[model samples]
Target: MGEKVLSVIPARKGSKGIPRKNVREFGDRPLVGHAIETCRESELIDTVAVTTDSQEIAQIGRRFDADVVIDRPKQLAADEVPLAPVIEHAFAEVDGEFDYVLCHQPTVPLIRPVSVDSGIRAGIQQTADSVVFVVDSTHHYWKQTDDGFEAVSSDRENRQLMEPIYGEIGVFLSHRDLVTRGKRIGGSIEFHTVDHWEGIDIDTYADWQTAESHRSRKQLVYRVTGNDQNGTGHIYRGITLADHLFEHDIVFAVEPNDNIAIDMLEGSNYDYQVFDDNASFVNFIEETSPFVVVNDILDTTADYVTALRAAGSRVVNFEDLGDGTEHADAVINALYEHSNPPENHYYGFKYFCLRGEFRYATQKSEISSVDRIMISFGGIDENNLTARTLQALAELDDQLYVDVVLGLGYADPEQLDPIVEALPDNLQVEINQQVQSMAQRMEQADLLITSNGRTLYEAGSLNLPVLSIAQNAREQKHPYAFVSRGVLSLGQAAYVSEEMIRTAVTDYITDETRRETMRTALADHDIANGIERIKQIVFDETHENR
Candidate 1:
């Protein structure tokens, strides 16, 4: 047999911040009704009761099928009165004796039934006199002193490094003897820490809005993969999309072998998990039952997307050209434009998501002379294009300044270093690795030489003229840069000789008219607000079916 536990909710009619907030409709039910439902659903709680001075609250409690509704005394319902006496009054009016009494606040409607059970279990297992719920407070404390206001602690470390301080969540469980003595908290106390969203206590209008926002949040899972072969553009794109979705619960689901994507996701604020294979990943999706599953992997299969939809998840795929595109809820192919796309398919450059740094970057200004040039491949230069591009630039005889930005997965650093060391004095070059901001670096250059990939869109947003070389067969299929007229494509790198690269660079430098025309063409397209467009598409597609 389980220990008998009585749950008591004390809701008064008088409220200063928002008048009559106790019986107000929150979400689909009244504010106090949520507390009643939570206690009734709890496995450990035997009896659920409400003690309120208002008759309306009593009716609501009865409508929600609460076990008991006690008439709270008028004196205990005042503005300045504390909760200890009210809980005591409710316990006295209850029919039978209970081993423990739980005081649950109606203001926090986001609290789950499992949390209540956890608090009761803690009090029983630990043999504690009381169990109080708390959350980690991130605010800095200060006090007024003779020399003006000063910090309460001498430690001035960052918020993450500082010692944690806990704030009560207005919900607690105590021994029956303590409740009868009109003391809510006492010796042998145990703390039950909850999530920050679950600790919200509604008092003001703003607090009510905050609680509603948290209540509407949904779980989102991003399935992405990255490595030396496929590059990390998909991981970068996933992180960029996740950053804009701050209101929703975000999780990154990757394969176990995707170590590059795991490393990138570790530096982010969101959470991620690794599944051993496709079968395990599908099982995880079924267990999680997320609102949406975004696939950033190059192409997904029909069977995989069908399993996701069967798990009640809306599937979103990026740059997918396989059979899964037909089954996905929405497919975004910003790199590859289709002539006859399906109704759910979104293509072209308008859906391209730029990084956050480019939002505040300064656009390029036309320079009469090509004094400086920047070379950058994607996150993983799988073909060692950086070294080849550098060698091509080293042949320039004019006094030229070159900046080479290497990616995190660039493997030919030893070979590239010797080339830079052997460059002539007239060809000055600087090598940078894993830069913080690519936009900042693009602003310092007159022209950009990059692979025919997402970097072209970033440079286009800055009005920087680009000369691109296709890194592989898959990249050669992307016709946006070639058709957009903003980029001068030199075909595939394997076919193009070093002399061809040297000639292209020399012609682009001397031809100011061509550079000016390319910049003007880039100004015609708006690529910076792709994040907003993609965000709207995700939300609309996910919520429309529901």
Candidate 2:
């Protein structure tokens, strides 16, 4: 005992912008087929009809399972005739009596069935004569006066803070009586707001291309963690990847108590969700059913990946060596080196995803002497290597300039303060905490002292020689820095003494030939295009499944 709704889709034969656009292939179906399928799938719509002058469009409508295909008259299909008369002609031709009539345009094929149902429900609930779909316009409006062009509004505000202006989306739901009166919109009208993509009206070739580009957009979820234990490399990488995927819906999923990741993401405009536990996260993923789930946490368990796959999400893991990597559709371990990796695994420095800053940074030039040295120990500096490296540099009798860039999660600031206070006059040390641009800092330095992590790849991009100290056993497993000879590895920090670091730095500075060789090796490697490579992998996987 509900109101009967009839959906009438008008797809005329003649098109001014694109010839025969009504039957043209869109994503996977013809242009008119999208509207027919959307209307047929709508729960509130009782009957779906397509009124078109072209026999080809009528056949496509029938193929898409449209309930009826009304033959529009030649006179009513004229270019100048308004849509109200055509809707009236279709309403009269349809046999069934409907309480509501929905006029859907085939040009706007991106409209979803849920939006259609919502418009109908709003019309019925509000008891309005018609419901018209609209989208909020963000563009600044202008008017041409006698003198010159002037702003439409006197109050000028930021685009984001501006008051909302609505534009019609060419789709409307009207009462049956209004359709008989040759009027689709009249009297008490209810406005239904839809997303910008759903409101795309294809009139020009550019509009068609825009709609096609939006058709491939999908929901992407990044399951990442950032803390003192694992450091914030994963979180930074996730943010960089999310920046490139602006067309899709991106969400960052973190652990319940991971305030470090939350605080970091607050600076970003992306949406994030914090889950209580593994079960809750999995349940949320299942409900969302995202197109892709990217895991940036160091390692993942088999059970966790299985749950994600069961949720119908394409799984991609970064720098993961756990058993779950076996089940992942794609595994990218740019930090670690493998002689032979699985077909799905992309390993080595070639897959390294550098930040945008490094991609455009100027490569370091050869120096006659090492004047400025940079010391950084990744984000967390769990082993307090920054202090150890600084202590090593202080013992040197040579007068040198040193810059210590501290990370956001550096916990041993107290330990670092004492080392800087007692530094000899020969070593002019500057302590920089949470520096904005790592690339700019690296460009100013002749040698870089850092942990064996993503930072090495970043330095390599600039052809800057590095003296590396492995923070842990897992970091020692990464052999690209050592194999490439770009970094003089001092082994693990626990085993490496102050004297050992001093010797390594002293040898690198004195042996100009070795430094030049290292720089050349780094320059020969191609790591700048890793982001584009990873983007291709993600889009290929999502597109194949779609």
Candidate 3:
């Protein structure tokens, strides 16, 4: 028999589903915390080590009292990466030899010390290959064939033999010596069964709820992680969506970048942290993992999605980009192009992107300029053409109030400072990337002006008669379409100059009929329901799989 017992938590850096599963929050603590705490709390386990490709997770492991944290190589972080190789490599590098290796995942948040002890004891007793955990299946399973569900049992006599077990569930115990010879189990394998609630592996929002309820019921202690910024759009939308989904949704973001994007979230009234690198994406997901992981971001080959799915996670995806994408449990795409052809493509928009409650207008048109004209542009003028547009408007003889709507994306604010100060008193500029008073400003303007992007849709939604300009080659030909619809006066975005802006506004201010015509056509119905409708359509399609 080997002298010492070793437990290894394998964590890889790339995760798109349940981003940072090992580090996700359960109750009020980090998921990995629960995993390590359980191990340290275990009496049989002499040494608990964490093997990960992410430095961030290793640090969290160390902080939480893991005996040793091995910084695994990046090559093993791929979706196709296997566990035996990782376990073998970890044991090879360790100081002492081990008879058994408990490859535990942090995402299995409820892995109590008792379960750990049970698995280890069972593994030692089986003296075979390994003793993994399994759950008893309750759902009636139908195997997909040329013919649908006949009877899982061929005959009534064998009905009793159709004993169901949700095989390959959470909790696995491995004998290191046997696995070292290139095998997961000896000739035989056994299972240490766990309750469904205890093995409630988390991966999706639903699983999160179950975990929360479990913690509340059991009074399980947890350290929740909510905020941190690693350029992935994870923390940004994660906290925001949680807020929308639940009223008391306690969310946070840790260690975000030093910029306006992260700064803006600070004011969102959510619990968050901006600390030194806490846990890399790896350790978090493996620790406080979810049951059904829903991935809408990162790449398809991301090991986070692959590993969880491999480990019996119900992996679902909501895609709008199109098909030729990676495999998923179920896909919900509400894009327009997908409907006509249906060639495994998601053509229109994403389901998760929610629009606010629809608010429409009774004022019809509220152009609030006494003598001067209103010049409105979008939040992100990636091209700094605002100054040029303003310069052209300045030459006009008419008293012009060019309301420059500044976006958050434009860089080099030092340059904008003087341009703002030196502007004519008649010309007022406003900057708020959040668009606080966006609707009011849009309605109050004499004629709307903006890019051919989402702002076009927004302006149309508001029935704000527009004077449009194309910001790019793709938009150049189409800004005219808005003009043709009479909702906006099109000045070719690329070729249009200040002369064109002044000329267009001169025409829009003069012709009130055209503005009304545009409003009547564009504001026929509320487009704000697009987001909810999007959600409905996706749910309708995906639920059909069941």
Candidate 4:
């Protein structure tokens, strides 16, 4: 018969550093349950068991599908009782003889099944009596001499120059006889090295917090505010960034009045919460204590970013042109035009956050004429840009067929009905709202008349010629929505003369060569990998800090 390995997780109910530490919740599972589950998941482990005097810990172990629960005597459950004897007692309680006895501490819940299995295989391969997991010790030891405190090691000049210092971790694998003899490392010992993060042992309140953070450390909190007045661009931007961070815990935070943000986040795998005001939002951030906070709101003050930083979160801002950019760890302004932003600020089309649909989208087919025009001004169109554009389109040839795309937050449907009804009999107009397939709709149209928002990037990805109009003064700073990038910028919607829109549309319709040139310009840039670049930055920060 093949060798059998028994995995034992020692989870005593009596904890001095933190009360009920063994049964305390770490992430979604109890502290001891993590160890039990990991042991059960290990391929090398033939049996999984837990040794505890407290029935509460035993119950938790059993609930996690542990094979056996050994009720340790009160003598072994004391604070000073060594883990070696506890492991031996648990092994004795199990029926079958085990070639290898593994002792995993419940406090180290971050330990993985693969690591356990690898350590066992390593022990067997090395023909060693014991195998212990360890991590590199970066800290230099100090000893108090008669004169003063001095460095323990002579080679204390630099960390790289030192030989090596490894601290023993919580995992131990030993021969069954050696464990019973109370000699875990008396025989030949093989060392299994793990990273510092994985080897963290929770013994105190601070250690518990560190472990808990490590357990839920990948959380990325997105703070976005959008509504009918301002539009849903911020919400869409946050969602785009969230999609890139799929492996991390994603959360969207929005203002209470922003129903558009709510509707967008509905049914999404990510969690969403609404804060009544800015103070409440800051409080929520402080309480959640996320690893990273991504702010997609238009502008941020120094106070807001400073408070978030004080709350213990790494901050990243999107499209932030305010003073908060000075304090933010990283700023991504994918829309704004800037030749030289700060070192941390990533601007220009190179950093443009493209939606998933547009990233791999096939090139849009070219039309001989601009008969099919798409008029879109983002979610709310607070200034009613859609109605204004339609008014200008009415002055043009009736042969023009307009597809007016309204955002989910569009407030005045009644106001638009009269404008549509008064259009010429020959002119055909259709309205599409809350479209799931924005790329599909863009693909159908040869030309797009839209505001300076994320849709501009989507249009450029599909090589769709755009007559872009800025929704507001802030949007007028958009760097990519210029004539050089295949877009005819009509300036801000409020100040732009109706004749300007009519002329730009009329000129583009007649000039097939110009339209073709614009479309070719749109196809020149490579934006398919922007999402990947953003992911790399976020993940790199997470791993380095971890």
**Winner by TM-score:** 2
Better of 2 and 3 by TM-score: 2
Q: For candidate 3, lDDT tens digit of each residue in 1-546? A: 333578777766666677777766677767777788888998778888888888788888888999989988777678787777877777776787677777777767776788778877776776756877776664445576787656554545443466664755545777776658755555567778787767877767787788777665411111122222212123333443444443122324344443443454566665543434323532443554534444444234544445655655445454323231455444544212233634333333223242242145333454433343344454446556666666665545555555566655555545766766776776666644345655566556555666654455556666666666766664453432443364454545667777777777676666666656776766663445444443333233342111
How do the residues 339-409 of candidate 2 rate in per-residue lDDT, one tens digit apiece?
77888888888778889899999997775688899998867787888888888877788778898888777
1 or 4: which has the higher lDDT?
A: 1
> What TM-score does model 4 achieve against the real structure?
0.63
**RMSD versus native structure for model 4:** 18.9
Worst 10 residues of 3 by lDDT: 218-227
**Stronger candidate by lDDT (2 vs 3):** 2
Residue ranges of candidate 2 with Cα displaced over 4 Å:
145-148, 541-546
Model 1: per-residue lDDT, tens digit, 1-546?
367999999998998899989989999999999999999999999999999999999999999999999989899999989998988889989999698899999988998998878888988999899999988996679999999999976888888988888989879998988988999999899999889889898989998999999998988898899876676788988999988987888999888778889888897756999888879989999998999989888788999899999999988889998899989999998897878878898888889999889878998767577888999986667667788888888778889889888877777567777888988899888887778888898988888999989999999999888888898888898877787777989888788777778898899889889888888888888898888888877766332210
TM-score of each predicted structure versus truth: 0.90, 0.96, 0.45, 0.63
Which is the better candidate, 3 or 4, if ranked by lDDT?
Answer: 4
Residue 534's lDDT in candidate 4: 68
Q: Which order, best to worst by lDDT?
A: 2, 1, 4, 3
Model 3, total clashes: 47
What TM-score number comes out for model 1? 0.90
Ranked by lDDT, the better of candidates 2 and 4 is 2
